[model samples]
Target: MNDDPRRIHCDRHGAQRPAFVCGHLVSGVGLGFVEPEGPQDEDASDEQAAWCDRCETARLAGGGWTAQSEAAAGITLVCAVCFEASRARNTHWMEGVARGWRHTDAR
Candidate 1:
């Protein structure tokens, strides 16, 4: 198995399967390590920022950046890319507290 913790989970999919790990391990699939923001650890979240080939490509297509929520993880590690994608999109798995795209009931 790959020893790289970064290579374990797909940013798009959560703990599941159907994920791909590049042999060379030389791709921009990873958005980078998510360092918690705020004054203390209580306000921290999203520890990992890795993505799969498909999701990574999509993210790049979506301007190469997304947003994050407050309930990510202190060390959100990806275990596998299951058939089902993450509850939230990869674009929402950003580091600091998400700024744009607020959930509203206006149409």
Candidate 2:
């Protein structure tokens, strides 16, 4: 059996899958995100990770994840499928362009 702490059952997925996302994303509606660079180059199955726009602004204002910014993020664990759903639900072309997300498609 896999002993990975990240492997947990999701009420929706009902299976062990490793993933996590911020609270805003779990309840996101076109909420943009800031993630590691080069997302467009990666495949969909690549590790899904992102923090919402509010967190990004706080991070920039604080010059990094200060205690306040970290608290505001409220990171939560979720299944891989849920992570993908959040990603899809939140990502928007116009929003990405406005936020200057570095992706070829956003141009």
Candidate 3:
């Protein structure tokens, strides 16, 4: 009977895939949450999550996460897999797909 809320049970991923993300991600409206720069930990988990530029500004407006900023963020809990998917959709990419380049090539 190990009851730890951090170790949540996701309906899709079974159990023990604790993660959290901003409201925009849950709503599928990714807002450019870039990945942390430099070397990453070997764990390879994107569960760190992030906030949009606007939200971040508000959060740090007074040098910290104020009550209003926290409310504006509206953090949401999600499975590890789901978190990864959100990160993929939100993070910026250095390269564009061939299909996207096709338009420039035609002109």
Greater lDDT among 2 and 3 belongs to 2
Question: Model 3 over residues 1-107: C-alpha lDDT tens digits?
Answer: 42876567777776666676768766564465633456665875655656665676776685756788878878788777877777667654432342252325565
CA deviation > 4 Å runs, candidate 2: 1-6, 38-47, 95-107
Residues 24-90 of candidate 1: C-alpha lDDT, one tens digit per residue: 1222333332222345445433342343444445445666334531122121333444211232333
- Global lDDT for candidate 3? 0.65
Q: How far is candidate 1 from the true structure (C-alpha RMSD, Å)?
A: 16.0
* Candidate ranking (TM-score, best to worst): 2, 3, 1
RMSD of each: 16.0, 7.6, 6.7
Lowest lDDT block of 10, candidate 3? 94-103
Look at candidate 1 and give me any clashing residue pairs: 16-80, 16-81, 16-82, 17-81, 17-82, 46-73, 67-91, 67-92
As for TM-score, the candidate ahead, 2 or 3, is 2
How far out, in Å, is residue 6 in model 3?
Answer: 4.8
Model 2 TM: 0.69
1-107, model 2: which lDDT tens digit per residue? 54666577888886667665778999887887667565353344445568888888998899866898878889787788888888778887787667687656755
Whole-model lDDT for model 2 versus the true structure? 0.76
